[model samples]
Target: MPSYTYPVAAPNRTLTTEEIHILLTNTRVLARRLADLTQMRFVADYLLSGRFDATGGGIFYETGEEIFAADAPEAVAPGSEYPKTVLTAGELASARTVKWGIETDITDEKIAQQGQVVVDRALARLANTVIRHVDATAWGVIASKVTSTEASAAWTTPGAALEAIVRVQEERAALGTGLDLSTVVLAPAQYAKVLAMLVDADALPRNDSNPVLDGTLPLRAFGLEWVTSPHVTGTDPWLIDRAQLGGMADQTLGSPGYVSASGVGIETLSNRHKDDKYEVRARRVTVPVVTEPMAGVRITGTGL
Candidate 1:
């Protein structure tokens, strides 16, 4: 029988202050890259500073108020008419912290092999988790707004999706709010489907030199800024009047404190096991709210 000898364990090596700084710096760079991947910054207006007060009030315009025309009379009527406005008080319903972290045992072998790469990957993952949470929260708020429907069939044609969006715009117009529908956000599959339709119909002007086709500019279709987000799944796409959608964040901590266009906070904690293990963490706090539900519409049943 052959006897097998156990491999010796590697010794633990303490990281120097300079090495620690480099790890943190690299981690921050990775976090920023992950933050750039988030989609909320393109669709929702964000307020980075202000405490979320549950007692805060919201203003709502009463719908269907009639406008009367005055006849040219010898005597001017002293009566004044004004649209009814209601102050609906409500608190910010969503306020929470999201966090992601990782712990790794520091081994001499790992240090020799540039173990900081592990921390860099962890920080990148954490940043992505935090940013995605913020985006999901924003989408949740937007989804809660008014919803409209299209024909219960898959949009197989290019202009078909545009028609669905136009219906939402028409609804806003019918409300007489004079809000311009400026933004359309859809799932990636839907966007690709619509783009193909446009291409097939020859409706989209094409130029090999065009920045939009070359990916230098954003894709704009039918006078609406087109945005694709994975957060929007299934058959529901959103049409929004930018003026009516607003969001704010408390700045008491800092500009976007926990969450921002840049990235979230990353911290390192020394473990009690004689530096045998250490923890790396990322965290963010944010609350996204829809200020005017009437200004946006969710289109469902696209069958995409």
Candidate 2:
């Protein structure tokens, strides 16, 4: 009692409300950038959900036959009725959760200033992992559903590539499905090769009047919109009707407050405890399906 005074405890300097806002903003921006870097999100339809549903279905019309009428005197029988076909998506056997967490020690002094950096790193990791899953799913759908694979060693030439795409279009037309092959998605290397060949052939239109040249490759030669993706893997290119691709996301999973609670779908969260540690997490439930196998064509063995 006569001797010593207790040392004053240091005041807690945890991140303030403003700093938290900044950290979240930065994390969101980084996450969006990662999404933009990958083509899967852009090419495939994206769905957001609050809940997960295992089964989904879509409907299509069967091709109707044309009846040729004989002379006016001859009676023509009515064409048989065509029934609508139903395609049910396979059950979503599983949901993928991509998440990351960060912890800062209690003694750390730069939590406010460096919080954004920590959050950014975690978000970047989450974004990349999610994109990889999405790309893999899309690739699988294309591989399993494409009507045919056109192998070619002539992809280096614009004419050859054009011919390959045209072949797909012709096949689809022959099926009389009326599914327009409007999008051409190629692996990065193949896209570059095609671009060079097109430039050499002067197939790209000139727009000297515009100060900025369009970096997008022109696909008018094949009557398609060109989309290049690193995710397309291998030497194959996919010609597809975008409408036939199915994508679903659990809306509730990615909601703003999902991190704290656990339910279904995608969610993100962050928190700090009395121990002076920080944490973050992300989760999602999604799947991609191909409603029509004949709506896509895969051109392979391009020798790229």
Candidate 3:
């Protein structure tokens, strides 16, 4: 019973002013690095995906008319002049880029107790917000410009899910513009239901068995790459012709107009708030437009 008293644990100490400055600087750098990568199950970038740079805050697009030939190529006689063709150019249109942003504050006391780990977590939340905002905004444009809607059998129906897509493909083919619907964005609930049906029907086979799919980042079936998002507000899945859907314009990083995967621009700013806290401001400057509304279609009646 004569054991020595246990040593008291060292108490945590508050970080110094200089230490806080260093922390803020590191966080800013982290934000810059995060900017290079942004693509994450976001349907906006995949659907309205003609990513390009804006010269003067506005993107000029052609609402091109889908011109179709009235007849097959006529066999031209050796000396006869080629048949004259008259064309009406598509009307010119423009969409302006609107800046979208979100921000948060990190208090000195919180960081003093929690360290930079908390700061990193907060930065992550900021990035997520920016990306999600881009998607939501893009979806808003799509919903507003939908050209057509088709009723679909619920995915639970063994053969109906695949058939619905085929029907849609047929409709697009009828447009005579070669609108190839290569991607589909599903509501989370519909996505889950489809995956279950695929497994039950042995379309998504087990690894041990002869795999029908490669188990890749983009889950594919029904002749299109499928993705799920919480932002896809309804049960209907959206089918899009990526090549002709529309375009998303963003502010250029430098002299070049190329934007990265996220179709977003992320900027992180930090400054000490009179020695009490640091504020981080993150933003994306971009706009989405359904320049070719007919290039996409929404499949409805998924639950039915």
Candidate 4:
């Protein structure tokens, strides 16, 4: 709603060992905050549905008429029988803001002296970049796929999944949406040979020690974040390693393909009763944290 920003900490000039400790304590909290904000952005932008090959845009929880859990009065206006409820829409308009309550310690003098300012700043930057990359990928996929905007879920064969990936690339090209799609979410088996193929094509890094493919390719780096549901079962779960998260953020996916008819329809549907059809909209929301990875740990000599 407000361009999605991370909470800012007030600046203080005082520097003490105890204050420094507090800053370090809050650093972890800020990292979690970054995660929370980025996760929200991911869900809002990337929820997928419909047939895998013929998938569509995702549906999000939006506001509309509300039926009270408890009922009392029926009508507030004269001659009105229908339940009166607040109708609303959009993430900014209806979604709850996620807050991470993080507080700093008062006794850490060194952290306070350093201000812990650098760490917080770095966390913010990282969060923004990760959220942006994820949003771009989600939109790229949606724009290229063939399906309905209201598509709830998707199921597809291996072949269709491959085709969908190709179509995604093409769609991006036509729409001037710049993205290189290399990694695709598919039934584990479907990706096995493809993984090998990627390796053979020199697209994937050569590594046998790490069972998980080095999805982080120079031309097409990949990092997988999975949602485990009862529907997705009996699968080899190893995809992307969380350790690789930092690297994947910078890599690009290789050339992709797309077809005009491949994606779901974007439309304005009229609700006759309401007498208006609202357009489904989209945007990439990012939350960023900027912090230094390593803070110098120096032992200061205080007269013992």
Candidate 5:
């Protein structure tokens, strides 16, 4: 077997910190690292499935006590016609659909010096920014529409978090919304506590074979899996029935010549001869709304 883990020739000289400092940004590792956030777009789409194809500037929905009321069938005489119920229109609500975009310029000289990877990197960076914004917008809408419920001391206290989660689950069942809240979006602090709680309960083995010891949290509890978002956080975590929570809308078509990306609106690249640079622009027109208020409940004060 090779001694330094890999076969080996010994180093001719020591790799001093002084020499490493010179090439730190470009080598030894990638010069840049993107944000490593938990993937939550699926969660967004699941909770907000109202996607429309039009790039129209406005979106309208109806809401009210009557529209949202759960109605049950009433029995009548076998041969009689069902009693007529007066139809009442719910209040109309409208939201403006907004366009979000980003643009950057790349010069030929920079491309020559740094290669096309530089341009690709710029595109990737800007694209991720747009995606992050989209998620943030959707999460913000959900957070704002949530019904605030009981607080919990789960973060620092063992056995306290599960009770809070159960209580909200019960409260939601009591509402008779006909939909069950299936997921909880937790914060990092609360998640750590849960890992400990699992080990304490003997649900996870306390050994090297345990996933937790290897820096992983593999767990399911109360018939639901927890979710976490860097953007969607506070003292309150959301418990939502993704299928009934809300929706999002965005425009699909672009002007005659612009390029298109899936789920993103329009993108265009053009050579700016006069300026000696290339311009890259992207736009995503989207709107998110919470139509069913009863579909989500906030687990308040858990981070505390």
Candidate 6:
């Protein structure tokens, strides 16, 4: 059997004392929230059967209620005119704010427990928001922040985001007796290329790779599974009813078999559907931080 060293090696980026201190200071909350959002996106799409369309920090529009009374002969019920309205996703860069402050000054065993609490709360909120937004008729299907700790350290690289996903999966695995990595699914961008690299490096199997199941691995942990988002347009396009459309619906068509009822308007429904990609960030709590000490690091020699 190949002997494995303690604290198995993993890739990491070095941070200066000033950076580390900042991470533990007011930035800790932001880091935690970013971690949560990263993981939530993974869970929502992979673990669950729903699709997550990225917004790329772009704004989106959603419809809302504007009351309108129905025409009646003699009876009247309480209702407002224009019963339905639209609600657009506000600009992310402008509307959202990230706040962070060290909840505790100590960094002992309590650190892990406290961090877990913070992570769980943010993750719960993220999951709830994504599901609610997707289910809402006004919002239709869109993606935004799952959770955010702060803006400073939101994920900028694929690797950082991937690691955050692994951390979340490992925690759940440890709690359950018979659980496996497959309970969670992972899909990465540039997955096929990454897989080829892994194969060349002799890290992954080259033949018969399979799509990952949920929790079976970290989201983006495997190079074989990748998910692509469709292209979306408009600054913030809300779903409008066909009737609300007027002269815009009466424009002349140039393509054959794609004309309107009067052969005047172009066919809009035949266009390919697309969605925006949201900017996401991911962070890990364990990289580089030695939360525990090892048994020995010194050698003793007899005097001779």
Best by lDDT: 3
Expressed as tens digits, the lDDT of each residue in 100-147 for candidate 2 is 222223212345557544444555455445556655665765676565
Question: lDDT per residue, candidate 1, 193-269, as tens digits?
Answer: 76676777877758742223654223665787666656765656667766555553422234221323352333333
**lDDT (Cα atoms) of all candidates against the true structure:** 0.50, 0.50, 0.67, 0.29, 0.57, 0.26
lDDT sort, best first: 3, 5, 1, 2, 4, 6
Candidate 6 lDDT over 221-275, as tens digits, reads 3432333212211221111111111100011223332212111101111111133
Q: Backbone collision count in every prediction?
A: 5, 10, 0, 50, 1, 38
lDDT of 3 by residue, 29-62 (tens): 4454344333243457667768767767888877
lDDT tens readout by residue for model 5, 1-304: 0001111233354434333222222221211211111112234554576665434777788643353324455788889887666666756877777777787876767665665455546656666667678768878888777665666665454456667777777876776657677777766666666666667777654563354655433234557656554567675666777667667776655565355543333344333446766666555677887777777777666654
Please state the error at residue 275 of candidate 2 in Å: 3.2
TM-score per model over all chains: 0.60, 0.61, 0.78, 0.23, 0.69, 0.20
C-alpha root-mean-square deviation, each candidate = 11.7, 13.4, 10.4, 23.9, 10.2, 26.6
2 against 6, candidate with superior lDDT: 2
Q: What is the lDDT of residue 197 in candidate 3?
A: 73
Candidate 4: tens digits of C-alpha lDDT, residues 42-92: 321223321111112221232221323334556457775777555443232
Question: Residue 51: error of model 3 in Å?
Answer: 1.4
Candidate 3: clashing pairs of residues: none
Residue 64 in model 2: shift from native, Å? 16
